[model samples]
Target: MPHDWKEIQAGDEEVFKKVFDSYYQPLCLYANKILNDIDLAQDLVSECFINFWEKRTSIEIRTSFKNYLLLSVRNISLMHLRKSGEKLGNSQFVIQELEYVEDYVNELEEEKQIVRVHQAINKLPEQRRKILQLAVYNNLSYKEIATFLGISVNTVKTQMGRAYRFLKEELKDDQLTLFLLFGSNFE
Candidate 1:
């Protein structure tokens, strides 16, 4: 659905919702990647959406709306960190993670794709899920994960291979998005 976001500034509520439904999860994930606290990330991203809606008539976005919303969330999350004086973790890691995801924003358009990936991952077997989590969530290499979990590298490799096949076969259209999101970990 191509949208005239410029027209959204004229108080088009329907398009506003379509935009909201489209970007909310990805923006939350982006903010969470930065803040590392899902609670704060959700709060900051929700506030961003609220403010976006309230000030919709005046918001001027020359870039894609995705960039604007992401920038807004990033700024607000950073501001929260600075104001609270909360040393959330390695700021370097947060910045690096943000940059990594931003590199793929152009390829990620449908929010449903993210939801589908999550659902598919949840449907995997218990050990397979653990392997995928250790790989993707912790960003651990197969050898590192095997050593840490006291398992053989072949077991780790096999589990990851099965997880990738499941996600690829189940999410046919979003294969690229899943690959782009989790490819580095599996490889």
Candidate 2:
């Protein structure tokens, strides 16, 4: 154990600091992999550590300290994603993400997949891209997007369909977008 759970539970600041120093960077990196946002990732990891310390006395750890901390960071990051999604719109992305994202994290840890996913999304046509963004990012409905873009609901749906098809083709080699593109009943 990198940390003395009993000593830390006894309220030793030095031991807590040591554990913090040992795991902070790696935990942040793990969170970044989960969130794709470095700033949010860092913030979440810091809070996870703080919570660990605050709950030390009552928390039971049957696993290694490192595993416990990693699990904590993962759960905290995913919870943040879910909550932020709810606040923003609670749309399809969040629902699909909750279902598929953990699979991606476990299967692919390389940074290249993130880059590839971004690039493929960027390659979409302007109108199609905008529709996709409004639907997924802004969490707008087909009717809402049609009104916002001054188009018919059918047109909005068509454009969004094309956008998803393009993204599916462009990202055929990567499953990272499975969360982003699927669950729309597009397939």
Candidate 3:
């Protein structure tokens, strides 16, 4: 009910506290769905609010304040996942637009597939695991990972290829297909 963002923009601490109290728990819960770690989710949501307060004067909210806060938390959660080397397979971290009731079921199924793929990635050899994590989780390009790890671009590419091949062999057919289809784009 506290929608007077004007006061918040004007450095009213009480109004900002009210807004935070209203949205913080719900935002944390929503972030937890994607992050799967309540502690990390709470931390990310806290960071989102901190950034929101810092940017209040310059930021414009075109939608409901709740929506803006939720979107902010979602983006921050995804950034945390990227930094932590976690990849949510298929859909590429997009918030899906559900067209039917069955889409919800499909979404759950996809989440399971993503978890399986992540497990398979964890089982990869150490070098390939690191390379694939950089590519998939960190969103690093081959050249960037090469530079970061002090390896050649060709080495990065070659390791990534072997990583995928190993993953294909390790996972079952359906899961491997899902990984192949939704996994990061390879060169």
Candidate 4:
């Protein structure tokens, strides 16, 4: 029988438990397919369930819970990949090996690097910082940034170039320090 998540949200713990039990393994397996790490996949699935439980009151079941869980796993996996700087490969063998370990420590280190990068950006002059933020964080093209900032495209490009140069100089030492501190073995 198909479980209606709406009913599960209506104060039915058993129904919710039944739904979770039914989909837990499958969701973890699906996440493993994307993340290539069994432990991370399991963690992602567990977090999904935690989120589901916390937000149960506002749950909407347009599709099956299975589909919902699968999508959540995929998104979480992608976020992990992005944060870890992992390359996407087409080799099944390599992917299988990725399932062996969950490098939470490395992920945390990468997060710290991201914070350092953010701080470095903040140290720039206000206009230069805005240009850099628009170009990098917002993924805006130089022309778009110029239009938004009411500046010439050439001026935007020049400012962005200077910003990158300054960032490179400022972060060079930190990058080496991070490499040493983090053991230089990241993806």
- What number of clashing residue pairs does each candidate have, in the order they appear? 0, 0, 0, 1
lDDT tens digits by residue: candidate 1, 1-187? 2244765777788888888786777778888887778988889989998899899878878766777877899889888988899876787877776676666565565556777878999999988998898988898999999998899999999999999888878877554677688865434
**Top lDDT hit:** 1
* Residue 179 miss distance in model 3 (angstroms): 52
The global C-alpha lDDT for each of the candidates, from Candidate 1 onward, is: 0.80, 0.74, 0.74, 0.69
User: What are the RMSDs of all candidates, in order?
Assistant: 12.3, 17.4, 20.3, 17.6
Q: What's the ranking of the predictions by lDDT, best on top? A: 1, 2, 3, 4
Candidate 4 Cα deviation (angstroms), residue 2: 5.8
TM-score of 3: 0.48
| Tens digits of lDDT, candidate 4, 1-187 | 2335666677688877877776677667667777779999899889988888888888776755555665566667778888899975555643443333223323544676778877877899999999877876687888999999999999987887787777667777465543443233210
Query: Using Cα atoms with residue i matched to residue i, what is each candidate's TM-score against the true structure?
Result: 0.52, 0.45, 0.48, 0.44
Instruction: Write one digit per residue (lDDT tens) for candidate 3, span 1-187.
Output: 2245888999999989978886677677777777789998899889998999999999988876666776787778778878888886445434642122124434654776677777888888888899888887788999999999999999999998888777767664454454465454532
**Colliding pairs, model 2:** none
Q: Best to worst by TM-score, what's the order? A: 1, 3, 2, 4
| Model 2 misplaced regions, further than 4 Å | 86-187
Model 3, residue 132: distance off in Å is 67
